[model samples]
Target chain A: MNGPSIQKPEIEFTDNIRDRNRYGRLWVYIFRFSTIIGIIALATLLFNIINQSSGYVVYEAKGDPAALTLDGVPIEEQTKDQLMRVLSSHLSKGAYSKLDRTKPFAERSRNDVYDLVVERIVKYEVVDSWLLWDSLTRKDEITAAVEEEYPEALLRFDVWINSDFLRRPQSSNPVIAGVRTAVLGSLWTIGITILFAFPLGVMAAIYLTEYAGDSWANRIIQTNINNLAGVPSIIYGILGLAIFVRALEPLTSGTLFGVTDPTSANGRTILSAGLTLGLLVLPLIIINAQEAIRAVPNSLRHAGYGLGATKWQTVWSHVLPNAIPGILTGTILAISRAIGETAPLVVIGASTVIYFDPEGPFSKFTTLPIQIYQWTSRPQDEFRFLAAAAILVLLALLLTLNAVAVLLRNRYSRRY
Target chain B: MEQIALGYPKSRNGLKRRFRVGENAILALLFISGVFSIFTTIGIVYELGKEALLFFRTPNVDLWSFLSGTQWQPHIDKFGILPLFTSTLITSLFAMLIAAPLGMGAAIYLSEYASEKVRGFLKPILEILAGIPTIVYGYFALTFMTPLLRTIFGRDVVEIYNTASAGLVMGILILPMIASMAEDALSAVPNALREAAYGLGGTKLEVALKVVVPAAISGIAAAFIVGISRAIGETMIVAVAAGAGPNFTFNPFKGAETMTGHIVRISGGDLSYDSIDYNSIFAIGLMLFFVTLTLNLISQQVVRRFREVYE
Candidate 1:
């Protein structure tokens, strides 16, 4: 009963829709392909790092540890006194004296002396190395290559990350190098960052959301904070270099407290780095905390007022308790950012090769990122391996902190 | 609660006064905290300006030559910034080429095409990409990307330390930023438009492209701008993989220096605090700061405009 004109229009429309659907499917596949690239990139990054961190190495000691052994006692098995003598006797008198002056060998443990002997005396130099995948899949090929490359060098599988990697301090030699000093410095700086940024950020957010009037001044402050968050971190480094390092050197270097080293002090201390990082993260915390505070229902505030509670009292008792979890969430993110940050610390003159742990707020410091950067820039392939291991440690620390934050956020969300 | 309120008598006016004083003190403290951000900005400008001004004040230095010249040999004392500026642009362009399309497409997929379950599973994975430190990415660029690139482009074509490797890794680093921001914009678009397109027999892709993308264009543009800013400011990747030699060439296969790379290289070396070379980095930093700041402000304005339209 339908007219030919109506049927013809319907058929044409159907054809057009079909053609569009085919093209749509093609575009959908392309979009999916783009998203897959991100996942692939992550996988590639992990694979590349893990591959470098472990492998086969053909190492040749310049002066073999066995030659230093008295009565066949290997260097690693030597007692503290014996190891000390071995290290001292092997080293040139001036070098030994310099080592002693740097840190007394007498006070160091047997393990430390043994490490020193291995590093200074034994001097294990990697002649050749292979990545983990090659070591595993092309085992015969690697063995042949090593043999062809150096018959004298010992061939063995090695995991770059071990207990020694965590315990030992920075060394010029990659075999003895570790992240101990850097880890301590990172912890100290992050500790200061949280102390400085957390309370101030939360307080500012509380004041703006709970107490402040809708005045132009308050509005300006709010906008300033938002802009600050977008500022490049290196600019903060410039500020830290200027204000904390130069202008406020007396305070940051602890000279104002009369406890700092007068000769070496230039305000390029952990205190300066931490305070700069604090500034870097302040806006982040304030923004996040503001969001948290704003999420609190107005009804709750009204209930407090109806109960004759003062504005401060209501915010303190009811609002703060409810908002604590959210504030913590923001703080966790800020701490993570500060911990991973390298540019500002570098700009503020954090020593890339610092061997000493941060002694106090005023002490010079280096962080995990700085350590990794320093190692990666070196021409040695072995330092790259060390950098990879340090990266794993850094990732573990960041992930644990972030996991806690996520858990808290989820728990609070579920409860409310 | 009622009994506690009643228990406060007129004789407890002293306690009330103490409480009021505490409140005022705390408010003042908060006000001080709020002003700290403003102080930081001022400190940055002042420090950068002071040294940058010192750089220009050097008797032999001509401002025009410094800005327009091509050579950046601090050893030779030639501080033309054109090479650095051009390298930065070339690297940033490569980064944009990789980031813009992939990030936008990923954002579209996450917001429009992906199911709820897929989006939930993928978002955190993308976030993990963001959480990775830049130093690590730098290493990946140096060791992995460089060799891989050399093999593909041939040994003669790709240098060991080239802009391509750094730019590629930087693109990966900023991909999460672009995707997340663009996804936010896409999600903000009302679903009613999508439903209307579907009712007219429009497919998912058609609806996403024709209906959602146009609606979210400003937001997507903001995401790309922010990505550019991030790429420009990134230090470790460029500093490590992009060679410190400031070259004016546009070839991605060759090594070149970026502004951040230049700053890091100079600062990391043994430069005296008062040296003209050290002060030169401050001038470079000033340029970087303004460029990034302007981009960020523009991005914010774009987002605001998008909000006005959609809301």
Candidate 2:
């Protein structure tokens, strides 16, 4: 190592250097802290959601479910037919007839009938709930509290996100509530969204990147897409309501196709919501697909042209195969977004309390986010737990979809 | 043999003519697909503008009073835009307060300090944060942040459904947007400037802050602007956590309605078509569209400016 130089700079070099070192070190910490805050925020979100989703609760049944059992079998162990019979036997004749009229008892799932029985006839009500930590740390206090406050209530440790929660339909009574209808609706909406957006988006991307010259029309199209991507989703809802719902009511309601239900002729159907969401995600898919298309090397195109192939032939054969995985990745991401979207759907008039599964595009629907929003808005504490559970389901679905897209993208990336 | 060669040329010419026709048709179809975005924009403007004009022309709307007034009680028929605008502003400002520093700091860390491996790993995690739906963020704000804030500031001081809770969650929601965009801007700066700073015996932090950040200021500004636009447009979180009623007070502790929240509230409720209350939502939506659209356009311009300078 060389010795220190005898000639020093005129400025206070050592002091300035020390000061700079301190400032730099402080800034490093600051930046690190900033990134850590993001990580912490994510952790907190997951933790908070999980924390709300499970706990111990003291529940009181409105009536004894055992009273409906004819064979002295436990209510939980009853067969599906037995459960249906038990459900009808316990309800008042008027109530039973009304329920039958809503949907034929035979047509509904065994699980659905059972949940209805539990909700309407048996009436499982959460008298009180304790957080997981409180239930664990202060068991005696909770026990005493339940004993004193609700002498007839049974206390049980409940996992809010159980399979039953997935199987049953939404209820005013949170104990028997599930996300079955919402899940089906979300799937239907996203199905239609992909159907409408994917092909159009890909075509737009291909035209913009491959076919179009540097013309004013192409530039305007690009500008419109960029601006559309930033438009608030609620605006799309207004468009859907005006154009799809009101202007094209016959088409959206399936009336033009002669599948008319008089009650649903108003055009507030899954079709409208799906189209609105399709518009919401269209810009995103186009942008991503363009990127994917642009990433295909010019050499591949040159080679195709050198073989005397037509432009369309080159694009169809050489360009598309390479870009398919990327395009799919973008489409999947857009689907994830469409599934989670609430604002545009809400604006398009998605039902907040639809009990039946959406049978077709013309059927009224409610998505998971809408369900969660509705549940959270309710004053009941049990519904809050149910909302938390629904949130978990939504997150899981989103993450899984995202993971699949990422995996496919990585697989394709390795080949290139 | 000459007749055979002439036949071949004739067939080839016919095939070429057919191909040209088919190709032009296909290009037209693709061009139509590209033009859909312009159609969407026109549709949005027409739909919003048509309803908004009707709302203004409705009896007793008094456009002047509606613009300048402070109270917003639609049920009682006092339709002031100020309360909604103010709440939107307050929440977005507070969100910016949280997002600006943290997002910038995270950007600096990812671009200047973290190794390539770390950045690759962390970047997706940040994207996960961005991917979490605003509705989930709403749930988080309502169930978690409000209670936490209550404990810190005391129960009476912070309402259960207040702007602070929604604002904070909204900040967290937009944090990734800011950080990712800022990082893109920072990394886009040429390495030569950074290398020159290091050669002058500058520390890593100094080189980043003094050299890189300034070089990327336009981009960082764009990121912040976009973040603000997102905050202003965000609906679910504010709708769920922010108070249902429109309060005229400036206190973030008290619940007030934002423009998006107002739109959602009206839409969720069973309001009749063409009712004053219903039309008012359209008007509020028009204002929201204006604000976000302007901010977005400005951000785009700023980013374009940066691209010209750096790229």
Candidate 3:
């Protein structure tokens, strides 16, 4: 019927091409600007952290180092015996014996003795500190302020993230405090988290992708996993507090194994923290593993089946090996999330001031994020600098993990 | 074949029988693993519910009062949750005000306008933004954003620990989340729709804004909802930047504690077990869990509806 209306209507084009193009260009710029905003935010965050991590500090020593010099030798050039003698004479009798009791001077290295002399006798206390930006641009102002405010204090530019900071454990005094214990705790917690979450996540993914077959139960399981992935991480901490820390205290505290330390008999151990993190990351791992498994072409499975293979055999021999790299990439990314996660760990009661390193799964622990959180909360400005330094360490760790994941995904991802 | 195949077939059948048992066993193991996620959900509900029940049962705390109360001082036994709830709402809304438009714009650009090279370069940057820890974001809020806010708005107008800084930094934290999700949704819109619009002589902006965006609206809505839920549930940022006490104030510059912030602050302290302080955090956690869960379910429903339209 429409064939009868063959005549074309008068072609009229709207004369707003210029306006449309202008708006289009403006919109594109807006979109581009949004992305630039994110980059700017990231750069500012990094810049801020780096700015705080190294700065000039005005420190006052409790006693003059020149007073302890032996036969006109400066404290720095003194021999190990001389340093020990200086420490012994300057330190109280109780303090001297306690230091020797903890670790005998004979067993201690010469540098260790010298450090003790400096820490105990010299006792450098930071009177004031300036951030890198101010330390650079307002150098004269800071110098003048420090001289007027702290006449006897020494002014020096200190990099907060030094080897000594990394080597020492946490202390109440910000001058000597370090993230050594927190770093060890993070490693231990993450090690246990991987051990707990990886295999279970992969197997669940295999089941959902292969064997579940769209059953109602499987659908519920799938939905549950998605919902769990969205659950606030702190809720997992509550669960850990209830389940791992309280209800299963015997297991988490190593009481059941008869290896409990009286001081650490509570369930706030690395094991509980790790398990909590594992649960928190489980949904992430499963979702990612499922994606990896689904990416394995169906042809691989069919080929295995054509060769008279069982379902598990096909999945194990063909699907898993093909999906391994993708799975690992996803898992590593999830693990990095766990590594940075502080909420649940805080809820699960990560120790904020633990000085000793985590000895095992049963030991009380504090993670790097916890250290950063605690340090940032302190009213003192120096603690903020310490937190920034810890943040840099954490960022370096997470970036390394992300880089490895990206490399693995790029290197081994199969085209099919 | 006629002479020796008899013994081979018998052994093969026996081996198959044994393999069947192993297969069933492995399947059972995998099934349990899949069920573990369900158990986790149950565990969360059970733990939160159990403690929350105890909290409600306390003579000092009634459900009605807890829901309607304004002050949340646990030491004085004031357990009203409105202060924390409103603070959370205010921060989340503030964050969404920033994240929603920016995220949608980035998504539209990446999906509709960006060249492949641009998308590739921009995507990793967003990923890095997402990968940065929230604690770092919290630090940024406290150290950089707060001071900047004070400078712009004036120190007298802005508290040192205020919701404005927390919400602003939180927007940055969740921007990548919304952008990537919305980008996926926009990218998923059948190209035929864009072509149809273009054939009708729609400009690039018109095609994106009127045709593609409306088509992907549900997915974008879901992304927005998820972003809000993330902002609500974000603990470290609010805890570190938001004030310690619960204050029912609508002003973004005023100090107030979110539910999450309260939980973190109280629980971070050395609370004895079975104390009202300890139990109250769980109650707050329970409320947080449900709010986030409801938001998540709604987003899932929206996403599912969107998937149905396309698939």
Candidate 4:
């Protein structure tokens, strides 16, 4: 008591949350740091997109401007970025083509030339960007006056929502950028992966649940299967490269050490991609499917037996129906993992791109993520915006699939 | 000798009095496919192992040097596994450092703190990060993430291909697994324990940390182990963001390769399977296989041994 003992505050209803922020400071710091990072990454992507999207300006002379014929009608025009590139290229090519050939480069007002280009776009001589942000915000005064003045000069504006972006192939000019081949490729490959993996996984599961004895033989088999599930997926790609593309093709073609079928997609096709992915997801499906089948009540099986139904009949008609929800859940999760897998595809060397939509299982193709990877890796900032848009599309697709799976799970669960 | 699966009560077959011999046949067939899958696994392993054996027999692949040496340039005649393994371990550890806490915190909030309505909204959003493809994550790491990390820290804190960026992005990639599975483990704890803790004047935090988590320790360990297993096997993100060099240092600012990275590198090349380079891929693959296999086995055993709690 002589040491000036501090008296602890008495417990009170109001004191329940004393220094509420103090106790969990570590956790709160971590939570805040994580949340801030997540938000910051998202914000950075968005801001970079908006910045790159604010491209440079361009201008063109009225009579001598570059012209393109649309539906046999000649139109002279320029978008800001396009105008800048064209002007820069022309100026670089020759002295006379420069905006102020006689004036000092520093003294020349290229801004006037830029305005003239914008004026020409406004004058209906050409179309402005169809980019949705600029279009929706419609700088009407900037574009409308030119259209009204150039009654004879047809104006074309770039609209971001045109069907062509999704309906066309990628072009050298990004103004006509599209993901048609890549989208179709992913769809077809995914279709194949699901088709191949699902039946095999389910069947393997059925065998495991209904069969496998307790002897060492069965145990070893089970242990090996579990280990197989843990193998790194890139190894599967190596297997595919050796087995599917190289060795088997030659043997399967009925040729002696010669896989000389010129027409054969150079041995890499959607079929190869699908099979590789199937192998990767196969172990997951089998394990989960087995668990799902095992979860079904034994009482139901006994009832089926009591009714004098055969074993196969009992399983097909009764056990399967009851186990539907678990099987579905397993399949959906497996599919979700498969959809996001990129490593094996890379190891197998998935075609970087294809100009045409896939015509068969043998046709070469790329996926959205691959395209996004290629685009984001580029030095140009415009491609980054395109990559972001593609990511948004991919995110929407994945979310919708997962939602459907969840919805089905809920709907089936209620019946049980 | 006529085939009759069953018989009426009036005229029972000799086999009906005991058990039908045919029952064994059906069970046998079911077990055969399990046997078949095992055979497939063995066949693949055998193929890889045989090639690797051949590689070791040659003077070119020095197993001792590969395992202990600092260099890992297989392309230009240097063979070292140490630096690659070190990078693999370092990146995986960094990823675990970030993901384990964030993921577990999210798990705790969902299980013990959030109302059902809040959980409903939060869980799906958490998975949003997971559903983004590994390739997309790789791009995000290279383009968006590296620059951000550079800005926050000084430029010296970053490399063209840094492990920190890839590891952090990979942490985000694997977060859903830890969160969802850990939540399952947390919820599996009996409500009675929580009630008893509250009865003893314990707060929600006390009940959760003391009773629920302790009870689910085995499952939580399984989650962490599985999460790390995934991080090790994950490929594209590391390949793109984490440079292919096998730097033996512990710096996350530097670039390094993992086993999966080496496999990708060889296969990505248009190399013939008969070559020494191609065989090296199999050798590395076998290593990856065993490493991940051990992790999975440990996880399975942990769950089996300590997970049970009677309701």
Candidate 5:
């Protein structure tokens, strides 16, 4: 096979090997660095949110608190009766009546009245705010800047994610704004979404795995599901708008059921958002459930048949039980995605500012992500801080859901 | 025979009929559920097509002009889609620029170099990155990435709502997706090829790059296409950070509205049902749907071909 044997360049070969090894090690570092970049991005995102959630705020009241004193008694020390008198005198008749109608002053506690006085009468306006990092690192600069800019303003380090932030409803004032309504809306929407999507998805998966033969209809259905999974989420919003919001308004707005709310007389209700999200996640759930069902051993089915169990009985008793954990894991992940979705809800007209909590599927709604988007869009820095705080809550909820899903998959998943 | 022996023939016949009915009913229900997914696709096409047809039928919205014109001021009766299309292209391409190399590198590391324990730890981290909400990524784009860019390139050079920040953050948002998909593809490449490369004195990097990666090129390409499709369809980040109004520009430093961003902006406002603005969003949405659907189908086809090659 060899016409001539050439002398081997041993030294050159050794040199080439050294160079290649050096380049190889360098590439390994580069690849590792590439992997670390994602971690860094995640860390930075969390850090940014945390940095903004707690911050130093410089604020001033339009009306002096000292002016509300009766016989040298401070507003905080004053009785509820005194606070009510101060509020009535300062606020217009219409405003005071509206406040009274909302929650009668008679039912209000002393502290509540005091808070109202401070909130409504004093009208604390945020002049400036600095993130946690700046407040901690550049404290003297911020102090000097605030002192020079706003002499009468009070400075305080405020933690924006307190219990009050979770309990209170939305407010135009960033200091008092909370995610109570948004959280409730999100809960109601997600609950309905799961109710609609879970059974339908599992059933579809069962039919595909257990019943469907190799027919053109089944193939098209399978392909359609895959394509639907990749469709832009906003397109689903369009479908929701045209179908659920308009075509099925009688149902989505609960008009057919005779449970219509004048505020949400139209179909931009939690039910519509929920149904849209259910559709959005349907393919995901189906695909996952199919995989889970396929993982069930064929022997199990044969064994069930040997015991004279019907096909339906075999699927319901044996296949479903074993596939439950995998199905649950997939559903949880899908639901988490639905939870974070904002565009579809926005397209379906999720109210940017709604103070009342959503009571049912027919109620007008806002979600935590929607709140964050709305708040972040505001020109005010304080709203940005509020948005950051809300992001913390959203992240916490998602992380917990993911952790549960992971645990379920790791703990219960069978190799088979 | 057994029923007749037990003297319950009529009852046994009735029970069998009921069981048969129940089984048929269950099958019908399951079949309907399976068919429901098809209805979703039909609904999307019907709704999008119906509204988009009306959008095109409007006297001012010439289909040719809408497809060709550069200006996109809907308020001024301008219905040009080029501005939005170009912006989408610019941002998507920029995202791929950052995502492709980094994602491929990460995929290689995970598939070829990392130990089992390392993979176990890294994979979940990547999943976490993938699972983080796009809205959160949008927030990071607006608050962090924009500021970082401003500091690096000067405030005057980098607009607050430029595509650069949005695109960069979008790259981060999709990196995990590309990485995971590409890793799956790379891992699918048989190890015999790797050993054969090593027998010829191939280094780990050479084997991974020259041998394994080439073998899995189709799968990796499919992953890239999917990543690009995802970038194009992504809404929240662009809506939040990629400017409000559409501008026909290729400059990443200057803010421009994407198709998804335009839809979000217009729909977020209160518009009458029959208004042009309301219908225009659907038109944009239809285009987005078709584009993403085509890309996804292509990627799926590529994946199928790759599977045939190995399996």
Candidate 6:
């Protein structure tokens, strides 16, 4: 009796799981399918863009000119000031000149039309053909561009490899068919959008994340922000039109434009376009930034408090720096989305007809998506090709920006 | 509890008191921002709300009519949003169907079958694919996927703008959502459970399906809902790949316009402020926002309930 002990019962249920296939085979199939799908998707995207972009016929030489020679000949014989005037297009009198030929593509690409009086166009060994597209389509406009710059060599105009329709700006002449103005417009617009939105977005995020105690108010704000992020962006367009365009026209400009006359943009300048876009992106920026800020530990905040620091000091000294990487990632994403935005800008009266680069924040501008849409909608086949090329460039810029953001976030992630 | 003196000092130090006072002002500063955000939110709501109310005041503003009607011609007379709403939900649901299985499959492979090394490589790659801009994916779906889809099933299978292609690409985007979330939930299951299953002579697949998955059911469900929200809010890919005309149809093969797509199309057409036409955007925006918010809230609550967090 002393030796006897209570015994635990033996487990009796049998699994009897007679699986047919090796587990690895099933998993291998799944993983392989996933990778294949992803790769194909990415490859198809890049390949289509490259194929379309490469098919574009680069003109021997082309661009906007300030004056027309009326005789269609090369401008190599023209003087420096005349070429400068031609390059400036009567907008401003900036000096320009002949860049050295036989340089690398990067250097050659840098040479403006003003610098290319004798300078070579991009990546072509053609010594004599002036950089220009044929006036086959544009009898009048072609004559004007040829008369302006190629007064000497206009007769020898053949499509060269230096200036594909992708590299130039919109003009009455197909010779000026490129995305330069659009690309710059996108840059400036997105730049302004970032500058306006970043501070406010980060501040709001900081307030929400590092400061707000868990409460009904905080929860409500968080919910509202997330919902705002989901709100169709066109609504923001309506908002921008009402609040920024019509209602605040006086603040934008007294006469709509600084000029004595009023235009469609009237007071609707690059600033207004950027501000509208800024508002559109602000909710996303705040949400992502809040997530980043929240990732920083409460222990870090407590440590600072334990050290007799104030909440502001603790956040500044510890929280923000820790969250910087995430904040940057979110900012970059917001910017990427802003760069691709077209709808809101169109509604806010972005000038679809602009030919010149925006002169200032007050000046009107057009961006990549807008320009692409204009080209895509047109009946011209060449314009479609040009649109494809422009898309490639836009994609590259967006990708590079996002990649850098991700890289930075990843690199810094290790430290924390 | 024993560190009673750790509490903030009741009296200020003379030398540091000014700094201390400034420091104390931080709470107020933060509180002020909270107040400011509140006001800003109110301002937006007021602006949008006023426009929506104004729209309702106009003749023949019936909520039921808007919900059930098919046409979306705001300028002429009939402004039915049902077609667009239907398209949005259908595309999102279609994407969920394709993505859920593939995503769950990948998750199972990741959590149960793959070694740590494979996981590291695959996870980052998948994320990178997911990280690529939706704009790029939009282009891909249109150019690449459409052609392939057409090849498999005639030209009728793919339209220049159709739900089928977009749903496919959106499925790819949601892949990461399901994978990461499912992995998180599945990985949360205890090792002891797996060992117990093995001791009972269960196969790996059996153990995964019967024990691990059931344990993580709530999380997996939440992941799928979050994926739905992601799909609903998805804009660029739809704008690019899916056609602009908002058709009221359930067929995935046909060109259907989503709510976001309609917004894009309208915004592109240059409507001036508060045009009875323009107020339609605000109403739609409110609808989209509410749907997504509810989905997100459900997702969050589900995660909280499912999260084990055992020490």
Residues B1-311, candidate 6: write the lDDT tens digits: 11211224444655443345664465555555445445545656666677777776677777777777888776566778889988888879878887798788878778888888978878876776666656556666666666677788788665667888888889888887788889888998999999999899777777888889998888899889888988887776777677878788888778888988777667665566667877777777667766876887788788788666655
Candidate 6 structure quality by residue, lDDT tens digits, A1-416: 79889776698755433333476357568755764565565566566655544322323333323234413544645555455444444333222222222232234333344344323222122222211222344445655664665454334443321354446556534434667788788888888898888887888887777656577777788777765665555657656766777678866543544454224456567777888898888888888888888888888888998998866788888889889898999889888888887767766777777766666676777888877666655545455455566677777787798789879887987443
**Residue lDDT tens for model 4, A118-143:** 33332322223333355447567546
Query: Each model's C-alpha lDDT?
Result: 0.86, 0.86, 0.90, 0.68, 0.90, 0.69
> Residue-wise lDDT of candidate 5 within B62-160, one digit each (tens)?
789988989998778999999999989988987998899999999999999999999999998899889988899899999999999999999899999
Better of 1 and 5 by lDDT: 5
State the DockQ of every prediction: 0.46, 0.47, 0.50, 0.33, 0.50, 0.32
Cα lDDT for residue A146, candidate 1: 83
Q: Which regions of candidate 3 fall more than 4 Å away from where they truly are?
A: A1-14, A100-111, A144-151, B1-19, B306-308
Residues forming the 10-long window of minimal summed lDDT in candidate 1 chain A: A6-15
Clashes of each: 0, 0, 0, 9, 0, 22
Would candidate 1 be rated incorrect, acceptable, medium or high by CAPRI criteria?
acceptable
Clashing pairs in 5: none
Cα error, candidate 2, residue B170 (Å): 0.5
Listed in order, each prediction's TM-score against the native is 0.94, 0.94, 0.94, 0.77, 0.94, 0.76
Candidates by lDDT, descending order: 3, 5, 1, 2, 6, 4
**C-alpha lDDT of residue A183 in model 3:** 96
lDDT per residue (tens digit) for residues B149-238 in model 1: 999989999998999899988999998899999999899888888899889978888889988899888999999999999999988899
The TM-scores of chain A alone, one per candidate, are 0.95, 0.94, 0.92, 0.66, 0.93, 0.69
Clashing pairs in 4: A59-A117, A60-A117, A122-A146, A122-A147, A123-A146, A127-A156, A130-A158, A130-A159, A130-A160
**Interface RMSD of structure candidate 4 (Å):** 4.8
Cα deviation of A117, candidate 1, in Å? 1.1
Question: Candidate 3's residue-wise lDDT over A264-298, tens digit each?
Answer: 73999999999999999999999999999999999
- By TM-score, how accurate is candidate 2? 0.94
Q: Candidate 5, residues A101-137: lDDT per residue as tens digits?
A: 8778888778667768878989899988999999999
Model 2, range B119-140, lDDT digits (tens) per residue? 9888888999999988999999
For every candidate in turn, the CA RMSD to the true structure comes to 4.1, 4.7, 4.9, 10.3, 4.6, 9.2
Q: In model 1, how large is the Cα lDDT of residue B235?
A: 86
